[model samples]
Target: MSLASREALASARERLDALADNTAVDAAKLAEELAAVTALLDREVSLRRVLTDPAQSGEAKAELARRLLAGQVGEECVELVGGMVRSRWSRSRDLVDAIEELASGADLIAAERAGDLDDVEDEVFRFGRIVASNPELRAALADKVADRRAKAELVRELLGGRANPVTERLVLRLVTAPRGRSLDGGLNALSKLAADRRNRMVAEVTSAVPLSDQQKQRLGEALATLYGRRVHLNLDVDPEIIGGIQVRIGDEVINGTIADRLAEASRRMAG
Candidate 1:
């Protein structure tokens, strides 16, 4: 996203957090409503263009959003979409993207309220890994020609009674309506959003073996101290690493694994 879209998204997130904090609001219902609105906007290019038109007054765009959504959606959703349309977007598509992200965030918040957020986050990550490791599963989910119903049923059969309801629903939505994203991309986005709910960054940590609870705690604390923010470790075990750990946070990687060290030493020797 460009700086403009990031700013707009941050502002929209703040409003979403405020809504989540409200005791009277039903976050799950709001999430569904927001998803519906996202679908509507995604399908209506002219409507999106008009709402995001810089020539139109923000108030006018917002009012139009409210009028269109008022009867079909709850007041909260109507107001939320109104507020989003009032913000400036880098492109009309960015507006739709922002709405989709907000809808996903709302669903995570609902899971958080139910004390199932951790489960949902882990489930999303695990599901991503599963899809990546299984070629047939990944192909089935990503197959554009397959029936949407079959894909949805495939999700249910795989995840039913095994994952949290929120996790299942989220994964299903992504697979059924990927819009132009790969399965891994969609899951990563959701995982990041879930981490944001706790104001934490996710560190993908790969080690030769599973870390003990104490080790995990110390590693998390050390990373948090280094980053000046809470860090959530998503551990992956790779025997190829030999020893030590490799940590990835976004584009930055801290490599301490024996494999990386050997490669570095080999390069130094050649130099």
Candidate 2:
């Protein structure tokens, strides 16, 4: 990772960081751009075909990738990718990792400020489960049915009103694709982005804030009781937690913050 090519990733990451805060960045445009990138990648297979041509040297294959990226994607894409080509990265994967990384990075940059879309997660998962559970769903997506519209319509029926526009469109694309025959892969693809989107590592913490020895001990015991397993506490800092400290375990943030207590008191008064 500390190689010269890593420097290109750093540069690309910097470019991407500037765009991350804008929630309105167009997914449709990004998807179109990514599709073009995938096409370029698919075309790169020819470079390997000539790699071992005895008359050709290693430099030739590197030059091939450089030209392709340069011509199709312009200087910025070309140079960053060209850096990788010139570097002695292994050719065994045939540059599959490089392509995948770029696409994933692009998606992350586009989705960075977009808040969580739980409907996408639930609907995509449900669609996958339905496909797996029903023979007809699998058949519709499979090559057995040549009508693309019908296959796509089935996907629409399953996902309509239940998923976001992005999920609806993307699921339609995948269902019409060959791999959609496998419910496992469809779910995996949909969930893959969600898992990637979930940037934070879940820390199931149980703590008495500004934890003293006895409170910490008792809080760990309580967390174990609630979680049904022992948890390591991050020991939050809050004076408002009158008796017990707040525990932040992943998305299920146990926010027994002083603010919550105040809100509850206000609610009772209003009633």
Candidate 3:
């Protein structure tokens, strides 16, 4: 996203956080309404362009959004979308993208309110791993020719009773309507969004053995200190590493495994 879009998205997120803070606002319902708006904007390219037109007055665009959304969605959603149109977007599509993000954010807020956010985060990560290991499933979910309802059902079938409802709904939404993102990309985005709810980073930790509670806590604390942000560990045991652990946060990797050291030594000898 461009700088303008980033600024716009940040402003939109603040608005959403404010709404989420209100106990009276139904986050899930807000999520659905925002999603509907996203779909509408996505389909109406000319309208999206007009709304984001730099030449147009912000207040006018906002009024247009409010009039269009008044009875179609809740007041909260109307206000949110109106606020979005009042801001400058780098591109018309960025406006739609921002609305979609708010939809997901609302769902995360709902999970947080229900005290199921942690479970939802873990479930999202596990589901991503499952998809990574299963090519057939990944292909099916990413299949554009497949019916959206079928993909939704597949997600529910796999996640129902096994994961948090928020996780299930999130996965279903992504699988059914990926918005041109790869499955992996979509899942990673969702995971990051979930983590962002608590202002934390997710560390993919692979160790030679499963870490104990104390070990996990200590590691999380250390990473948090290093990064200056709280870190959530998504752990995996890989005995093949022989010893130590490997931590991945975004594109950065910290490799401490015996296997990595041996490989480095072998390369040095070969040189």
Candidate 4:
């Protein structure tokens, strides 16, 4: 997204932040609204892609967006989408993220009110870092550097042992998310959203191999104790990590892997 578009999205996010107050929103009603917004954004994004493709003319794309959203979208949604189209923000990732924020904010509020949504939000952030840290894996997921099925397979073969059930499912879902824009864009939005759902942040831990069930339970308990609050640990597995564990929570990283130690040694020697 362009800088201008990013600024606009920031503006939109500020507008939506007001709804985050749990007291202001009706949990049940807002959940329904959130669902509606998600569906609307999905359809809008789909229409935007179909319309904005270089293969399709602008007029053709406009007409299509109109037809698809005209009856299906609510009055406010229609106006919001139409404004985006007019502003040429239909293809902007910033705007898409803005829409996602509005929807996710509503979900978070509803979940808070219901008191059932666990700390999945942190897990999502950790998942993003896991993907971003691995060049080959990140390329495969975000850039189609590998075949789709290969990407899916890599998730099973490499990540099977490393990540938690939720993390594994999240990766697979991102790899297979139906494309309106790039799958990465949609998946990234959703992942960040999952993080925003929790009260406490997520810490994603990577291991060379799968941790045993006993280890997982112990590790979770240990982490919760350390943080003085419950924390969700999403597991990630990569053979290249090469022994030990790498735990990442936001910008903080604890790399205990042999590979990392070697890299650190090399850096120190060079300096």
Candidate 5:
């Protein structure tokens, strides 16, 4: 995103925060509505371009958004979308991306308010790992030619009662309407968004064995101290690592597994 788009998105997030702070507002419904708006804008390129057009007055674009969304969505959603159009976006697609982000953020906020955010975050990461391991399932969800309804049903069947409602909804939306994102990419994006809800960083921790609660706590604390932010662990088990753990925070990796050590030693000998 350009600076303008980033600023616009930041302002929109603040607006979402205000809405979330209101006990009367339904964050889930807000999420659904924003997703709908995002889908609409993504499909209607000309309209999005017009809404983000610099020549048009901000009020005009805002009014147009309000008029288009008035009866179809709630007042809060209409106002939110209206405010978004009233702001300058670097590109029309940036507008859609910001709204999509807001949709995910709204779902995270819903989970947070319901005290299920931690579970949702963990569920998202675990689901991504599951998809990574299951080629058939990943293909099913990633199939663009597949019927949307079928994919939606598969998502619901997999997540319905087994996961938090917010998690189910977020996954269902991404799987059903990927918007050209690969399955893993979409899932990772959702996981990151979930972490950002609390201003935390996610550390992907892979180990030969599951870490105990104390171990997880200490590792999280150490990473937090290192990164200067709260860290959430996305734990994975892989016996192939043989011992110790591998921690991935974004592009950086802290490798301590026996497999990694052996590989390095073999490379040194080969050299």
Candidate 6:
């Protein structure tokens, strides 16, 4: 995100946090309502463009948003969307993206309130792995021609009682309305959002075997020290790595595995 978008997101997050802090507000309903607004903005290009138009005054755009969303959504949802339009977005789509993020954040907050946030995060990661490992499943979820209702039912059947409710809802929403994102992309986004709820970065750690508890702690601490931010380890066992571990944080990879060394050596020899 650009500096402008980051500022906008931060401001929006403050509003969400305030809403979450209110004991009377229902977090789950807030999530669903925000998601509906996200869908509305996503489908209505002209409306999004108008809301994000630089030429229009922020207050004017906000009033328009409030008027459109007033009776359709809760007061909190109306205020939230109205606030979002009051900020400047770099692109029209950024507005929808921000709303989508808030929706995910709201769901995570619900899980946190239920003391199931960690479970939801792990479930999301595990579900991503399941989808990645099964080509048939991946194809089924990614099939554009398939009915979305059928796809959602398949998701419910696969995940129903097995995963946290928030996890199930997040995955179901992604599969039902991908918005041009792949299943992997959607899962990745959700995972990151889950981590962000705790103000941590996720490190995809691959090793030949599962790291011990002490080892996991040490690695997490080392990553935190290296990155200057709290790190959450998403451990993966890949025997192909031979030894050591490979850590990936976003685009940066710190490869210490024998497999990576050998691959580098092979490339150098070819060169």
Q: TM-score of each candidate?
A: 0.96, 0.49, 0.98, 0.46, 0.98, 0.93
What C-alpha lDDT do the candidate models reach, one value each? 0.92, 0.53, 0.94, 0.59, 0.94, 0.93
Model 1: residues with Cα > 4 Å off, grouped in runs: 269-271
For residues 1-271, what per-residue lDDT tens digits would candidate 4 score against the true structure?
7666666555554444544552654533443443454445565656545533556554665566566667665543444444444333435444545554555555555555555345334445555666677777666775544576877787787568765444455456457433444544555565546554554456778899999999888877877787776666778789998899998776788788999999999999999
Q: How well is each residue in 1-271 modelled by candidate 5, as lDDT tens digits?
A: 9999999999999999999899899999999999999999999999999999999999999999988999999999999999999999999999999999999999999999989999999999999988999999999999999999999999999998999999999999899888888989999999999888999998999999999999999999999999999999999999999999999988899999999999999999999
Q: Over 4 Å off in model 2, which ranges?
A: 1-28, 47-94, 97-112, 144-150, 177-181, 200-271
RMSD of each: 1.3, 13.4, 0.9, 9.0, 0.9, 1.7
The model with the greater TM-score, 1 or 2, is: 1
In the range 99-200, model 3's lDDT, one tens digit per residue, is 999999999999999999999988899999999989999999999999999999899899899888889888888888788989999899999999999999
Q: What's the true lDDT of residue 177 in model 5?
A: 82
lDDT by residue (237-263, candidate 1, tens digit) is: 899999999999988999999999899
> How does residue 242 of candidate 3 score in lDDT?
99
Report the CA-based lDDT of candidate 4 relative to the real structure.
0.59
Tens-digit lDDT string for candidate 6 (111-144) = 9999998899889999999999999999998899
On lDDT, the stronger of 3 and 6 is 3
Against the correct fold, how does model 5 do in TM-score? 0.98
If the candidates were sorted by their TM-score against the true structure, best first, what order would they fall in?
3, 5, 1, 6, 2, 4
Tens digits of lDDT, candidate 2, 155-213 = 77877776666667667656554332364665555555554454322223333345678
Clash pairs detected, candidate 3: none
lDDT, residue 34, candidate 5: 95
Error of 3 at 191 (Å): 0.9
Task: State the displacement of the C-alpha of residue 126, model 3, in Å, after optimal TM-score superposition.
Answer: 0.4
Ranking by lDDT: 5, 3, 6, 1, 4, 2
